[model samples]
Target: MINLHGINCPEWVSIGGDQRRFDDSGKPVDPSTADRAERVLATFVRLSSKVSA
Candidate 1:
């Protein structure tokens, strides 16, 4: 996990079909699922920061 501001963002997030994983940098373990993973890690950090603020 990567700590952003005060949130503990997960290093890998399971998303979309088959629950493909995406790293904290938004890189998918399987390149084929890249489109599905998106930048969810960044999104979480952004949203969490807003909530905490």
Candidate 2:
């Protein structure tokens, strides 16, 4: 069995965030972005289909 024995992760929910900004290193960061839901749903569909079929 795949054991997730010692992972520390809080439950995630939809939330708002400030506008995306770049830091000193020019790395884009979103303090509170919620745009990942579509990506998550797509991945779930793909994985579920593979496992079920």
Candidate 3:
């Protein structure tokens, strides 16, 4: 499992066939599928901030 909290995943990949989201432990998280894109963008922003710092 990828340590998203540690490395900062920049993409919100589809976990289930219905565009669901899951955490490293295979649990249902982020109930809003529509927010996936924004979530991924947020991660990229955080990663960029860390990289630029």
**Against the unseen true structure, what C-alpha lDDT does each candidate score?**
0.62, 0.49, 0.66
TM-score of 1: 0.37
Q: What is the lDDT of candidate 2?
A: 0.49
Per-residue alpha-carbon lDDT of candidate 3 for residues 1-53, written as tens digits (9 for 90 to 100): 35654664648646567556567886556666546656877888888887777
What's the lDDT for residue 45 in model 2?
Answer: 70
Of 1 and 2, the candidate ahead on TM-score is 2
For candidate 2, write residues 29-48 as lDDT tens digits. Answer: 65334345445556667766
Q: Arrange candidates, best lDDT first.
A: 3, 1, 2
Which is the winner by TM-score between candidate 1 and candidate 3?
Answer: 3
- How does each model score on TM-score? 0.37, 0.40, 0.40
Q: Could you tell me the lDDT of residue 9 within candidate 2?
A: 23
Instruction: State each model's C-alpha RMSD to the native.
Output: 8.1, 10.4, 9.8
- Evaluate model 3: give its TM-score: 0.40
